[model samples]
Target: MRCETIREALSARIDGEPEPVAAGSADRHLDACADCRSWYRRAESLQRTLTARPGPPVPDLTADILRRLPPDWPLSSVP
Candidate 1:
């Protein structure tokens, strides 16, 4: 597998996102590629850092958007 594809899979795996069976291929590539190994380490570190810290308060973007919409806006037409 290419470095770019493996890197994407690495991030997705860290995020607990779904991926194909080829994730194992990415792992094997990690074993062979020093740069990918470093990237994986950094990705892991970042994931840990994010999990350890409190998330910033997330604004309710959906509600904000609803408020901005006109009363006559065709909500039913939105996908």
Candidate 2:
């Protein structure tokens, strides 16, 4: 398989989504492809780093948002 295709499958696998290619096939490719193995390691490291840190706390804007909208803002006038 092409490197591009294998990478896509690797990404899907990393994301816990279904891989486009079979797992065994991707693994076999990884075993033989040094570039792909490096790419996968980097990708995994990046994923871990991204998910390990917590971002700034999110503010609740629900009330502020609702107050700015008209009562019937989302509803069309009936004929």
Candidate 3:
């Protein structure tokens, strides 16, 4: 398959979603195409980074907890 076509399918293949190319086709393309291989490597690294990142904090969690507790429960309110 052409690099562009394979590149688009690379993500689907990695994610185990449906892709245009048959099984082993992407691997074959990667072996023969340095550019596609590099692109695939970069994409894989990006997915790893994205999946590893911490999710966003719960919204206003501190405020909600503080509201549920007594004011005297605070250790230091000066801050």
Evaluate all candidate structures by whole-model CA lDDT and list the values in order: 0.88, 0.94, 0.84
Ranking by lDDT: 2, 1, 3
Instruction: Give the number of the best model, judged by TM-score.
Output: 2
Clashes of each: 0, 0, 0
Per-residue lDDT for 1-79 in model 3, tens only?
7888898789897787898887589888889999998999999999989989999876768777677787578658638
Which residue pairs of candidate 2 clash?
none
Between prediction 1 and prediction 3, the one with superior lDDT is 1
lDDT (Cα, tens digit) per residue for candidate 1, span 1-79: 7788888888889989975537779879988999999999998998899899997898779988988999999999989
Candidate 3 C-alpha error for residue 48, in Å: 0.5
Model 1 scores worst on lDDT over the 10 consecutive residues at 18-27
Question: What order do candidates take by TM-score, descending?
Answer: 2, 3, 1
Better of 1 and 2 by lDDT: 2
Candidate 3 local Cα displacement, residue 21, angstroms = 0.8
True-vs-predicted CA distance for residue 43, candidate 1, Å: 0.8
List the candidate 2 regions with Cα displacement exceeding 4 Å: 57-79
Better candidate by TM-score, 2 or 3: 2
TM-score per candidate, in order? 0.63, 0.72, 0.68
Mind giving the per-residue lDDT tens digits that candidate 2 earns over 19-62? 99999999999999999999999999999999998998999998
